[model samples]
Target: MADPAGLPPRLRPSTVPPPAAVTRALHAINTCTSAAALAPLRVHILREPALLRSTAVISAFFLACGRLRSLDPALVLFASLPRPHVFVFNSLLRSLPQAPACSPLPLLRHFLGLGARPNRYTFPLMLTSLSSLRELNVAHSQVAKSGFARDLHVRNALLARYAACDPDLGHAEQLFDEMPRPDVVSWTTVITAYRNHGHSFLALATFRRMFAASVAPNRVTMVSALGACAAHGAVDTGIWIHQYVQKLGWELDVVLGTALVDMYGKCGHVAEGVRVFSKMTERNVFTWNSIIGAFALVQDGEMALRWFFRMKADGIRPDAVTLICVLYACVHAGLVDIGRKIFNLIVQGEYGFQPGIKHFGCMVDLLSRSGHLNDAFRVVEAMPSQPNAVIWGLLLRGCKDHGDSVLSEHVTMQLLELEPENASHYVTLANLYAETGRWLEAHEVLKWMKEKGLAKDAGWSLRMLEDRSSKCISDGNFMECAL
Candidate 1:
């Protein structure tokens, strides 16, 4: 016998020796990091039945490496095995459910092609891969037909899948109600489903049901509930969840701590949001984006900018989401110079980073708001491609503010032509014409609006009284021609 790692024997078996070649092949296969390295090893292994030391070990290795690449490699290895068993089949099938762009239907077809039947592990991943309600129904039918619908894990995964896709929450609630023996995971999944769909009340109701059933809320459950409370602006319930977290002494963990920061920030408690952020010993990009967005939303643009700079200083790279918030803050505070500088830095000065429509809109808004209508128009013209409706609309608004009748008229024609059904475009154009004392043009625009069977939506204005601090609402639906 040859040392598997050394050289092959002088007189090899005509049929090839099984254990030795397999051991050597497995060693070579294990060292492969990328798909390219696997090709030669795979070819060498497939040449001789001796390539696999044990069918079992080879199958396990295939599945283990499946995480790095996918089930395709495992499936290829399984094809060459002398005696492929259910374990190998199961490994490949299990890999399919989580595979990149992996389809449950295709995996099921492959299983059937292999003359193998799905066991308990099969349906859990299949149900998870069903990206939509239509796919869920197909998986649900397969589960029922396979007679594994009652299996706890399979059923729980199915419940989670339904919870994720059932936007109305009515179906998910009914399914949860019918489950005779729901576990903590099942309860949490359904509760989270409601939360994800923006049904905060139902999530709370689900929590109450869990407590009534004597089920203790775990970290996942509490975190989800806190998130729901924050999203729906349930400040009181959010506070209660915080107290519960403190009681359980789980606040130190970064994951839950970040969620708390996000929840408080969204609920308009900037102070609490900052406190939670300070408590987080480990902060990810998501945490930074959430807190920054919160400050922007609350009109604390300077605080938003401060945190943005601080985030970069702390060695955290600013992602597109961070830049979007920063640009928005600049727009809110009318910081045109700063906005222009940031825009130039990100879009032009940076090597790989590119600006999207959101960034362009910010620039247009910044230039337009500061009465630089021509500069704003020039920005749109200089865009690599044609401007979008949003881009053009920003210029039109700037035209309105600066009373740039020519620019307003030009943008109005372009906007209306682009988005004819948009009622605001017609109104904006008509307003521009009226502002310029072009009664004939204004009436013609209004006439076209009527001819197109589009009724102008009544416009309203909001004004705050300086002395009384009271808001006055004025109905400006009826157009007035001062000319």
Candidate 2:
């Protein structure tokens, strides 16, 4: 008879192993570094279907597949199970988010249909799959029906889901307010939701409230708060957080260190950011990017480029973000030649990067700033995607700065076509005409602006008026005409 274990002809499946032996094999499978290495044991277990009854074996296999990020095999294993327990379902649920291609909802439905009940961990795993507000509402209903609504862990997961997926923060706020015993994770999620939605002030306010409540913040909480400080330019508060971090003896892990660097840099304190960066015992690509970005933000192009070289020398390859920062620095410093070299490097895949729109935008800005208007136009023409308004705006601004009214007119027409109702484009065109001494054309633009109901913003100017009495006193001709 053919080998039922599906092994090579030279190999044979062992007899049904003792429970202790099965336990040892399960441990081996759990600790496996790769899916390929786990195959033989999987086949061995398949040959002895009795081993599949053990929840540990099933969970470990799914976990191993999850670790490998191989979800299809996990699905096959799941289907082959005669009766999958909650552990198996939970393991698969945990793996779903990592597998972008697979939807967890179907598997979740299957689990429920099999008469398996979800535990606290189950709802959180299921909640991760809810990508939209509608989906979230449905999942929230499920949580309530399953009686896991009040579970702190599940509630925290729901909070995170809303924070990450929902457009409006109203629901997240309501959930936060409803939590009578909100934990650190709950506070962090609410703060993060505000920060993500660009309400930095609110995020900071929430952080202060959390502090007042005496619930000690965790690493995640600090990161979110620091991000808010960075966005809102709350340097004093950021400094306080930095001091608090030191007081708590929290090792400045790469993530927290990067956040601090970003906060200080955005607050116009690049020197302090550098100080924190230099003191870090460990660093990642994000750390390098943060420091590079700090230099870019301060318009210190030379230092930014210097750090770029240093990052390469230290064996940290530059990603798209790093390249963008370097290009921005080049633009600010007018490093035309260096910018071209960097652009070419990206085109040639020197760092394995594909130039996205932002990268192309940077190139356009760099070239236009250097008075290479023709070269900048050529870059826009060569872009894989259409140039966005920012790119055209850069070109038009360049034309105006360089007194190229003809090119400015052409770019303005394109801008107008793309964004017909954008008043700024008309203003820019009018400014170009005015700069070139084309008074009639400028007036015509003003007329068009008026016709379009784009009211020109009122201009204000100030002139110093000399006090005649003071001047007369200074000149020794003082007469107190009226006391």
Candidate 3:
């Protein structure tokens, strides 16, 4: 018997004509959390003459229930409404995007049929569900036809749609530069598209260009550039960016701070990573993961474990990423028992978190490093399903570690079947054969790899430069890259 519309007392519309019906419908829409409430609300509106005709009342109801449960009711209500206008169609189209289950194509068809020109809001929402470039190009054409091209918001959304669908960043750049004056979102979208396409240098250049144009970068711009710096191991540039962030008094932002830590960590500045991490006022799961990984990468597994325990004690739940980093720590520290314990925790602990391929790979590495080749094989054999290339690759590497020729051969065959083009598989198997002085067999394996046109990789060097003054150089052995 409570008023079905659950408007807060302060927000309740006082001057509205049908207060009780409005209040009840609003409550049903806003307060309704389940399908049962939605069913009754639908019946109530249909039965109530006053509520049936008010667009404001119906729109409020749909907005309150959100898109998932409101679609069918919206359609029913649209059919019954005496004058369903363009705004009504727009509302329905907007709702279609809220749920991944509902396809936007039907809504697009309906909108076109109504001859309703898609306003600025329409294409952006429609672009979200688009899966292919062809559909996106169609949407892009519609935007031009509607003359929203010069509208910055619509253009920015178009840039985003292109950035998302187009593998090449050319269209993104063109769209970005064509804007009369690109705003921060425009610049950020362009930079992000380049960064995502593995053009880190280009992303960094864009940021500089934005700055050179007297356009100030926002938090998103700085964060994205910092990510590119991190990936490329440009520590000096990263540090300069960090200083800029601090000077602007934005260093306290958790997102930006976390990126700084990750950048420093990946650049081989572990101490700097720890320093940035310590200064963070707010630590997220990613923050913990970065610091732990930094320690693990530096072979300071003890510190990684320390942080892992601290993370749990701090009441932040560990996710698969957290576990993966901790498992790597166990691998580095040669803590087979600890690795097994962590593996069991993931597989059967109170959280009952499912183990991913990386987790299983860590387990295999741990077991193999401990001279437990058969146990490593057992772990692979006991997997819930067939193993992936990583699992088989790890097992093969473990066999190499323990000089187990038979198991190595078996794993090599499996790896070849899983990833036939992987040159390293043949190389690993060849190395195992050579260990037993089976030179001919080893040479044959290498010959087969060459014959298959799988090119073996050579070692590479990474030189990160910061201006002409500061540089940090690091070289990685091929083992890590090969795996």
lDDT of 1 by residue, 418-480 (tens): 888976777666566555545455566666766786654524310111111111112222234
What C-alpha lDDT values do all the predictions have? 0.74, 0.82, 0.75
**Candidate 3: regions farther than 4 A off:** 1-23, 34-53, 64-70, 79-87, 98-102, 105-109, 112-118, 420-483
lDDT of 2 at 234: 98
TM-score of each: 0.79, 0.77, 0.80
Candidate 2 clashing pairs, residues 3+ apart or interchain: none
Estimate, for each residue in 59-130, the C-alpha lDDT of model 3 and write its tens digit. 765554454454666656655665545555556655654334656666666666665566777777677767
Where is model 1 more than 4 Å wrong at Cα? 1-18, 33-84, 97-102, 106-117, 165-171, 349-352, 384-386, 456-482
Ranking by lDDT: 2, 3, 1
lDDT of 3 at 35: 52
RMSD of 3: 10.8
